[model samples]
Target: MKKLTYLFIALFSLSLLTTSCREEKTASEKVEEAIEDTGDAIEDAADDVEDEVEDITDDNK
Candidate 1:
């Protein structure tokens, strides 16, 4: 009976550890997300600049 109890406890602890570890993102995943966000921001800024240039040219003409 004691051995069975120990086995159950060990399995429970292992499962909890694995579940907790999976909840957090890895370093590489975080860096990838940051890079993607930065790319999006740069694209948006470029679009805004293009619109401003077009407006300026239209006014000059």
Candidate 2:
């Protein structure tokens, strides 16, 4: 009976540890996401600037 109890406890702990180990994004994944976000923001700002320039040129003409 004692051995069965110990075996059950060990299996429960193992299952818990394995579940906790799953797919939390690593540091590199986080850094890549940040870089992609920064690139997107830069692209958006550039597009806004281009639109503004076009509007100004249109108004001047």
Candidate 3:
């Protein structure tokens, strides 16, 4: 009876540990994705600024 109880406890712990380890996106991957997204946003903003500048310069000409 004690053996069965110990076996059940071990199985339960293993399942719990495995589930905890199964999350996607580790810290480094999340950081890298955020950096890439930020870079894209910055590039887009720069493009917008350049477009606005060109429009202003054209208007002034």
The clash numbers for all candidates, in the given order, read 0, 0, 0
1-61 per-residue lDDT for model 3 (tens digits):
9999999999999998887555699999999999999999999999999999999999999
The stretch of ten residues in a row with the least summed lDDT in candidate 2 is 15-24
Tens digits of per-residue lDDT for model 2, 1-61 = 9999999999999998888556789999999999999999999999999999999999999
- Best model number under TM-score: 2
Per-candidate TM vs. native? 0.63, 0.63, 0.62
lDDT of each: 0.95, 0.96, 0.96
* Backbone clashes in model 1, listed as residue pairs: none
For 1-61, candidate 1 gives per-residue lDDT tens digits of 9999999999999998887444678999999999999999999999999999999999999
lDDT of 3: 0.96
Off by over 4 Å in 3: 1-23
Better of 1 and 2 by lDDT: 2
